[model samples]
Target: MKQVLTIAGSDSGGGAGIQADIKTFQELDVFGTSVITAVTAQNTRGVIDVAPVPIENIEKQLQAVGDDFDIAAVKTGMLFDAVTIRTVADSIKHYNWQRLVVDPVMIAKGGASLLKEEAKDSLIKHLLPLATLVTPNIPEAEALSGIQIYNEQTRRMAAEQILKSGAQGVLIKGGHGADPDFTEDFYLDQHGGSLVLRSSRIQTKHTHGTGCTFSAALAAEFAKGKSIEEAFLTAKQFIQSAIEHSLNIGAGHGPTNHSAYRHYAQKEMIRYVH
Candidate 1:
């Protein structure tokens, strides 16, 4: 099995962060390894507190993983501060890990700031350039690109601005969009290739780990040597299935079913335009 690594925070609820990444990797038949950058006291309701892992310990964990595993791909999420972002970026450079999926996790579902307000610049400067693909939701894309996305034209402009920041590709997720019936994600690469992926929105409050899960699945697919377009399509299908069969275990927003893709693979569908 191919090995992939997730450098992210630990979610006490087991819905997002490292837990979701590992679960997604397992469902995709890849070996999952992790380096926890922060630990959050969170549950379905909201995040209570977050403690970032010390910089030294974070570096040590990365070293341990890099030394031991022949990791095929990597994904990063919920890096709380500038120091953690720089540390992760340096480690990725040292290990020469090329296939990197950056899930720019800025906020929790309940409006808690996961990434620091001051860390945004560091992420743009130190990390974005190294990313093979950067996945950001509508808000995050606005923050990164400094462009307000109000329509399809502005969305493409924002993506182009992000690509200028050095990421090879960007996927502006549409889950946070105003469209009530359908969600559309826009993908743009450095080579001028673009794809618009659309799927029927599943009405549910249980989408806690959707970003983490989708990016993790993308990394797993890349680890297995799939093309960028192929990986995005598969990851889209995976998240749709997970959300369609979401688990309603919590009182607040619950989590998407991590294992649902395998069971519903034949039933889920996503439409894309190249």
Candidate 2:
């Protein structure tokens, strides 16, 4: 089986961050490894408090896995702060691991701050250039590019800027924009080309952890040897189906059904062999 590593915070809520990332990897039939940067006391309601794991522990976790396994791809979520970002960045550079995907998770679904204001520069300088693909939603795109992406044109512009900032590819998720049809996800390639993917927008309150799940699935798909664009589309469909089947369990934003892929894989095989 393929192996993928997700370096991010832990959500006790099991919706976003490492929890969701592991589920994505498993759905794609990849072995998942993780290095926790922060731990959150979160549930269905909201994230209550976050305690960042020590920088040394974070480094050890990365070293432990990276030393033993051929990590096909790596994805990051919330780094928590500057020191933690630096720690993770150093490990990645030291290992020179390829196929990196950076999901710029800035805030939580319940309006809690997941990343520190002071860590933004470090992430850009140290971590982003190493990414094969950087996935950031609309608000995160605005924060990263300092440009207001109000429409498709601006979203394209933002994608260009993000790509130039260091990553080989940029996927600007349009979930934040009030687009009528669906969230128009933009993909800007290294050769200055672009692809926009549109899906049926599932209107539901349980939209939490969607970004993390999307990016993680993309990484998992890439680890399975799919092209960057293919990975993005695979992840898009995964998120869409997950959202469609998400249970109304929580009071606030609930979790996606990451396990939906099991149903899909079984059903697809049955149809193919019939």
Candidate 3:
């Protein structure tokens, strides 16, 4: 089995962050390991508190994982501050781990900020250059690129701006868009390849971990040696299925069903054969 690593915060609700990443990795048939950057006191409703792990401890965790596990791919989420982001970036360089998926986790479902405002520069300057793919939702894309995305033209512009930050590819997720009929994600790569991936919008509030899950699925596919285009398609399919069968476990924004993708795939396979 391919081993994948997630360097992220821990969500007490088990709906997002490392919990969701690990669950997605497992559902995708990859071995999941984690280095928790912080611990959040959050439920489905909102984040109550956050305690960032010490920088030294974070370094030690990365060292331990880098020293032992043959991590095939890595996805990072919720590196709270500039220091944490720098540490993770340095570790990624030290290990020379390539197949990296950077999920620019900026905000929570209930309007809580996940990434520090001051650390945005650190993320773009340090971590993004090491990313094989950078996945950002609409709001995050706007924040990163300094371009407001209102339509397809603006969306493409924002993606292009983000691509300039050194990531090989940029996937701007449309989950946060105003589209009521279809969600259209824009993808742009350094090789001049661009695609508009569209999916029917699932009208549900259980999308707490959609970004994390999508990026994690992408990392798992990359670990399995899938091309960026193939991995991008699979990740989109995985998130769509997960959202279509979303779970209503919390009072506020719940989580997408992590196992729904496999079940959906099985049913599709059976249908295709018959």
Candidate 4:
């Protein structure tokens, strides 16, 4: 069985962060492992508190994983400060791991930030260049590029800037800025080619952990030996299905049902097949 690692913060709510990454890995048939950088008290409403795990402990956890498994791929979620980001980046560099997926987890669904302003520079300057793919939502793309991405044109520009910053690839997600009727995601390859993926907007509040889930699935598919384009396509489909079947439970924004697509969508299949 292939193994995938997620270096991130733990979400106490069990809906996003490390918890969501694990669920995504499991759903995609990959063994999930983690090195936690912080712990957050969070729920649908918002994050109540966040405690950055000591940098030394974070480093030790990462090292422990490296020693045990020939880690297939790695996807990172939240590194709260400069110290943790620097530490994780160096550890990843030390291992020279393959297929690194960096989810620029800047803020939570409810606008609670999971990363420090100071750490942002280090993440872009150090970690991103080493990644096989960098996944960022609109705001995250803007933060990294230092430009406000207000529409499709600016979104492309942001993706280009991030790519120029040394990342091998970039996925500028459109969940935050898409038209109410459509959702689009962009991917830029190392060879200077790019692809755009669009989905019909699902009206719901269960959008938590979407960034973590998408990036993790992307890494999982790559770990299982799929091509970057093939992996990106499969991961995008999985995430869209997950979002469409989200549970309408939480008061604010709920979580997607991770097991949603296990069984086929018979009705839709029939509708399309016929």
Best by lDDT: 1
Q: Which parts of model 4 have CA positions greater than 4 angstroms off? A: 266-274
Residues 1-274, model 4: lDDT tens digits: 8999999999887888899899989988999999999999988899999999988799889999999988899999998998888888898989888899999898888778788888898998889988999999888999999889887678777888898878899988889874998777887776768787777788888888788888988999999999877787777787788888877868988877777757546112101100
Candidate 1 residue pairs in backbone clash: none
Q: Tens digit of lDDT per residue, candidate 3, span 223-265?
A: 9999877787888888889888877899988988999987876
- Model 1, span 1-274: residue lDDT tens: 9999999999999999999999999999999999999999999998999999999999999999999999999999999999999999999999999799999999999999999899999999999999999999999999999999989999999999999989999999999999999899899999889998888988999999899999999999999999988898899999999889978879988988999988875444465566
Better of 2 and 3 by TM-score: 3
Query: The CA-based lDDT of model 3 is what?
Result: 0.90
- Which residues of candidate 3, in runs, are more than 4 Å off? 265-274
Candidate 2 is scored at a TM of 0.94
Q: How many residue pairs clash in each candidate?
A: 0, 0, 0, 0
Better of 2 and 3 by lDDT: 3
Native-to-model Cα distance after best TM-score fit, residue 126 in candidate 3, in Å: 0.7
Best by the TM-score measure: 1
In order, candidate lDDTs are 0.93, 0.85, 0.90, 0.85
